[model samples]
Target: MSEPDVSKVLRLFKEEVKVINVGLEYFYKELRKQGVNAAHVIWQPKPELEKDLEDILKKIL
Candidate 1:
Protein backbone atom coordinates (compact mmCIF):
# COMPACT_ATOMS: atom_id res chain seq x y z
CA MET A 1 0.00 0.00 0.00
CA SER A 2 1.09 3.57 -0.64
CA GLU A 3 2.26 5.66 2.31
CA PRO A 4 -0.33 8.00 3.83
CA ASP A 5 0.04 11.76 3.43
CA VAL A 6 1.19 12.72 6.91
CA SER A 7 1.46 16.36 5.94
CA LYS A 8 -2.24 16.95 6.42
CA VAL A 9 -2.03 16.64 10.20
CA LEU A 10 0.61 19.37 10.42
CA ARG A 11 -1.54 21.74 8.41
CA LEU A 12 -3.83 24.42 9.81
CA PHE A 13 -7.24 23.65 11.24
CA LYS A 14 -10.43 25.30 9.96
CA GLU A 15 -11.37 27.12 13.19
CA GLU A 16 -7.81 27.98 14.13
CA VAL A 17 -7.91 31.12 12.01
CA LYS A 18 -9.04 34.41 13.48
CA VAL A 19 -10.54 37.24 11.49
CA ILE A 20 -10.59 40.92 12.37
CA ASN A 21 -11.22 44.48 11.15
CA VAL A 22 -12.79 44.96 7.73
CA GLY A 23 -11.84 41.43 6.69
CA LEU A 24 -13.98 39.58 9.22
CA GLU A 25 -17.02 40.26 7.07
CA TYR A 26 -16.23 37.55 4.58
CA PHE A 27 -13.81 35.50 6.65
CA TYR A 28 -16.27 32.74 7.37
CA LYS A 29 -17.19 32.46 3.71
CA GLU A 30 -13.65 31.70 2.56
CA LEU A 31 -12.91 29.50 5.58
CA ARG A 32 -15.84 27.23 4.77
CA LYS A 33 -14.65 26.78 1.19
CA GLN A 34 -11.05 25.88 2.06
CA GLY A 35 -12.03 23.30 4.71
CA VAL A 36 -9.53 24.98 7.02
CA ASN A 37 -9.33 28.30 8.78
CA ALA A 38 -5.71 28.90 7.60
CA ALA A 39 -5.53 32.03 9.75
CA HIS A 40 -3.57 32.11 12.96
CA VAL A 41 -2.51 35.15 15.03
CA ILE A 42 -4.38 38.32 14.27
CA TRP A 43 -1.29 40.42 14.85
CA GLN A 44 1.58 40.67 12.31
CA PRO A 45 1.44 38.91 8.99
CA LYS A 46 4.00 36.23 8.09
CA PRO A 47 6.81 37.57 5.91
CA GLU A 48 6.51 34.75 3.39
CA LEU A 49 2.75 35.19 3.02
CA GLU A 50 2.94 39.00 3.18
CA LYS A 51 2.94 39.47 -0.57
CA ASP A 52 -0.10 37.28 -1.11
CA LEU A 53 -1.90 38.74 1.91
CA GLU A 54 -1.28 42.28 0.76
CA ASP A 55 -2.67 41.50 -2.66
CA ILE A 56 -5.76 39.97 -1.12
CA LEU A 57 -6.26 42.81 1.38
CA LYS A 58 -5.89 45.42 -1.34
CA LYS A 59 -8.47 43.73 -3.49
CA ILE A 60 -10.92 43.00 -0.70
CA LEU A 61 -10.43 45.92 1.68
Candidate 2:
Protein backbone atom coordinates (compact mmCIF):
# COMPACT_ATOMS: atom_id res chain seq x y z
CA MET A 1 0.00 0.00 0.00
CA SER A 2 1.09 3.56 -0.70
CA GLU A 3 0.78 6.59 1.56
CA PRO A 4 -1.80 9.28 0.74
CA ASP A 5 -0.80 12.70 -0.64
CA VAL A 6 0.33 14.99 2.20
CA SER A 7 -1.48 18.04 0.83
CA LYS A 8 -4.86 16.30 0.85
CA VAL A 9 -4.33 15.11 4.44
CA LEU A 10 -3.36 18.63 5.51
CA ARG A 11 -6.49 20.16 3.92
CA LEU A 12 -8.68 17.64 5.73
CA PHE A 13 -6.96 18.42 9.01
CA LYS A 14 -7.65 22.15 8.51
CA GLU A 15 -11.39 21.66 7.97
CA GLU A 16 -13.83 21.95 10.85
CA VAL A 17 -14.93 18.71 12.49
CA LYS A 18 -18.66 18.07 12.86
CA VAL A 19 -20.09 15.00 14.51
CA ILE A 20 -23.50 13.42 14.82
CA ASN A 21 -23.39 11.67 18.16
CA VAL A 22 -26.08 9.05 18.24
CA GLY A 23 -27.09 6.81 21.17
CA LEU A 24 -24.44 7.98 23.66
CA GLU A 25 -24.07 11.46 25.17
CA TYR A 26 -20.62 10.69 26.62
CA PHE A 27 -18.95 10.89 23.23
CA TYR A 28 -20.65 14.23 22.51
CA LYS A 29 -19.44 15.67 25.81
CA GLU A 30 -15.86 14.60 25.14
CA LEU A 31 -15.97 16.11 21.67
CA ARG A 32 -17.36 19.41 23.03
CA LYS A 33 -14.58 19.48 25.63
CA GLN A 34 -12.10 19.33 22.74
CA GLY A 35 -13.83 22.28 20.93
CA VAL A 36 -15.44 20.05 18.33
CA ASN A 37 -18.90 20.68 16.86
CA ALA A 38 -21.02 17.86 18.20
CA ALA A 39 -24.71 17.12 17.82
CA HIS A 40 -26.57 14.60 19.92
CA VAL A 41 -29.37 12.36 18.71
CA ILE A 42 -31.48 10.14 20.87
CA TRP A 43 -31.52 6.46 19.94
CA GLN A 44 -33.77 3.74 21.22
CA PRO A 45 -35.29 0.49 20.07
CA LYS A 46 -38.36 0.88 17.90
CA PRO A 47 -41.65 0.42 19.67
CA GLU A 48 -42.84 -2.01 16.99
CA LEU A 49 -39.84 -4.24 17.58
CA GLU A 50 -40.50 -4.29 21.30
CA LYS A 51 -44.11 -5.21 20.68
CA ASP A 52 -43.17 -7.99 18.27
CA LEU A 53 -40.38 -9.41 20.44
CA GLU A 54 -41.97 -8.94 23.82
CA ASP A 55 -42.59 -12.66 24.20
CA ILE A 56 -39.01 -13.63 23.42
CA LEU A 57 -37.54 -10.92 25.65
CA LYS A 58 -39.78 -11.96 28.50
CA LYS A 59 -38.61 -15.53 28.22
CA ILE A 60 -34.94 -14.51 28.08
CA LEU A 61 -35.09 -11.90 30.80
Count the clashes in each prediction.
Answer: 1, 0
Candidate 1 Cα misplacement greater than 4 A, ranges: 1-23, 37-61
Q: Write the per-residue lDDT of candidate 1 for residues 1-61, one digit (tens) a residue.
A: 9999867556746336544333353665676567754543345554675788889988998
Per-model TM-score on C-alpha atoms? 0.21, 0.54
Error of 1 at 37 (Å): 5.7
- Residue-by-residue lDDT tens digits, candidate 2, 6-56: 997798799987889998889989999999988999898776755658988
Candidate 2 stretches greater than 4 Å from native: 1-14, 49-61
Give me the overall lDDT of model 1: 0.59
lDDT of each: 0.59, 0.86
Candidate 2: worst 10 consecutive residues by lDDT?
A: 44-53
